[model samples]
Target: MSNIELNDKKIQILEVAEKLFSEKGFDGTSIRDISKMAKINIAMVSYYFGSKERLLEALILYKTSDLKLQIESLLHENLEPLDKVNKLVEIYINRINCNRGIYRILHFELTSKKREENLAAFAELKKGNLKSLETIIREGQSKGIFRTDVVIPLITPTILGTFFHFHMNKPFFQELLHLNTETLYNDYIKNSLTKHIQQTIKALLVYEN
Candidate 1:
């Protein structure tokens, strides 16, 4: 179901679930915990989502639906391939910044025991996004703007891994860099980290032997 179609109560449950799941992990957080946190009955959550797994999937879909739409819009725009790629980096960084909890939930689930089952939907979403990036890269190659030998698979990892690595190491980096405030750390991600990722992707795509 679309994010718009979800009622207020369902959205509330999902939001609470996202936070709890991020903090306590998917298995650690229970339906009762979500109900208590959301100030709703456990029965209401099951009535809306049927199961914990389904609820998690719904939350993921809700978080990612907007990104998918934005990516589609960017793909249809009449911009240069490199420009589109840069815009994508900005969009991705913004999404991560705004929904750090959701990303944490995703990372936790992907490493947990039920990872394969829990992450199936997310894997599909990631696949589609990768395909979109591949399309852009291919388009650039056709235009002779991007290197013909550039590997899409390697490029995807370099971009996404960089973001993930920075996010996962926030505390360490903060201490190392003496980023005394959350505002400063977030600013670094939004400005410095984003520019670094964008430049890395562009350099990889356009580099010539």
Candidate 2:
């Protein structure tokens, strides 16, 4: 096939794969499903993306690149570090709310065997983002806007928790916390953001020097 033909097919496969993987999840969506939805042959899907797992990696890379660029652009110039931390969460949360499915897929794949081996690229990207957070937190501490005792290495999970739990758990959250389902979506986030961000900022900024 010609290069243009391959490019068109690859784009189509990516589009179909993203929606299917996001909606049906990695385990549920098969190559046949993607091929069928894409109106292409299985070989073509595999040929274009190499494998289902690679297709997903491509999807994640696409989403991450765009999002990271936006974040870097927003934070590139002058801004307070603590405020940047809050903006990080706010921007992330806003992005997730807009496209929860992609976040869900990324959350799901981060644990998969196929994804684990292919995760070195993602790890680098993640490390870069974490470094940005660390820098902001450190700066906030210096400014006395946050506590001085917070350790950057120790807080990655908490930041990830804020992102993951919101998408992964909702029914049990409502049942256990006895909160309404509909309202919990946004209201819970508002509450969590206010409390978590403030406490996280303080905990990471507490006196260490």
Candidate lDDT (C-alpha), each: 0.85, 0.69
lDDT of 1 by residue, 1-209 (tens): 33436988988999999999888988899999999999999999888888888888889899997887788788889999999999989998899789988876776555566575655777888888888888888999999899988878787668667988887888899998888799999898889999999999888889565
Deviating ranges (above 4 Å) for candidate 1: 1-4, 111-114
**Segments in model 2 whose C-alpha atoms lie over 4 Å from true places:** 1-11, 112-114, 144-148, 172-195, 206-209
What tens-digit string does per-residue lDDT give for candidate 2 at 103-208?
A: 7776666565456666565666677777777777767767877666566775656666666775578776677776776776677666675457556655555554
Point to the candidate with the largest TM-score.
1
Clashing residue pairs in candidate 2, if any? 147-205, 147-206, 148-205, 148-206, 148-207, 149-206, 150-204
Weakest ten-residue segment in model 1 by summed lDDT: 107-116
TM-score, cand. 2 vs. native: 0.74
In candidate 1, how many clashes are counted? Answer: 0
TM-score of every candidate relative to the true structure: 0.91, 0.74
Looking at model 2, which ten-residue stretch has the lowest summed lDDT?
1-10
Could you say which candidate leads in lDDT? 1
Give lDDT for model 1: 0.85
